[model samples]
Target: AQTVTQSQPEMSVQEAETVTLSCTYDTSESDYYLFWYKQPPSRQMILVIRQEAYKQQNATENRFSVNFQKAAKSFSLKISDSQLGDAAMYFCAYRDTYSGGGADGLTFGKGTHLIIQP
Candidate 1:
């Protein structure tokens, strides 16, 4: 079993600013995937970005990016030019590629409450 931790329960950022959410995990598997998901008011789990354990390069999508340190088992999300819509609960998730159970083997952190101020 694996566990993910988000030390900060909440974070705040002014509109159009930048913010980074930290995440760390413990796992015994050598190959896996890391993901950042955003859950808005609608309660939809939107994929923000993903990073492969074997890939040395970080993953980025538009205003969202991840700082993945495989050796340190840390994956943090950075949101640039943050928008009001970006205000939501962010989750750090992990999945083992060889799990063969799909979403069933996914482990997630408690989540960070992101407050976007005007």
Candidate 2:
């Protein structure tokens, strides 16, 4: 079973600053996928970024980037030039490649609540 762990329960950052959210996972398989989803007060799950296990270079999207340490089983999200809109609950998720699309669902971490101070 693949599991994700988020050590931080909550975090706060000043507007226009930066923040980093920590996430770690345990998995036996090598080929898989990792994702970070953002849920705002509206309660919509938005795909923030994704990283393929086979890729050595971490994924970056605009102000968002990941520090993927495969050997350490750690994948962290770095939000630069943060804004008030960035305030939300961030969830780390994992998908197994060999699940055959059966009863397997995205395994998600407890989530980190990010609060932005304007």
lDDT of each: 0.93, 0.95
User: Once superposed on the true structure, which residue ranges of model 1 sit more than 4 Å away at CA?
Assistant: 100-104
Model 2 residue runs over 4 Å out of place are 98-104
Give lDDT tens digits, candidate 1, residues 1-118. 8999998899999999999999999999888999999999899999889898999999999999999988899999999999998999999999888656555567999999999999
Residue 38 lDDT (model 2): 100
Using lDDT as the measure, the top candidate is: 2
Cα RMSD of all models vs. native, in order, equals: 1.3, 1.5
Model 2: worst 10 consecutive residues (lDDT sum): 96-105
| 10 residues in a row with least lDDT, candidate 1 | 97-106
Per-residue lDDT, model 2, residue 83, is: 92
Query: How accurate locally is residue 45 in candidate 1, as Cα lDDT from 0 to 100?
Result: 94
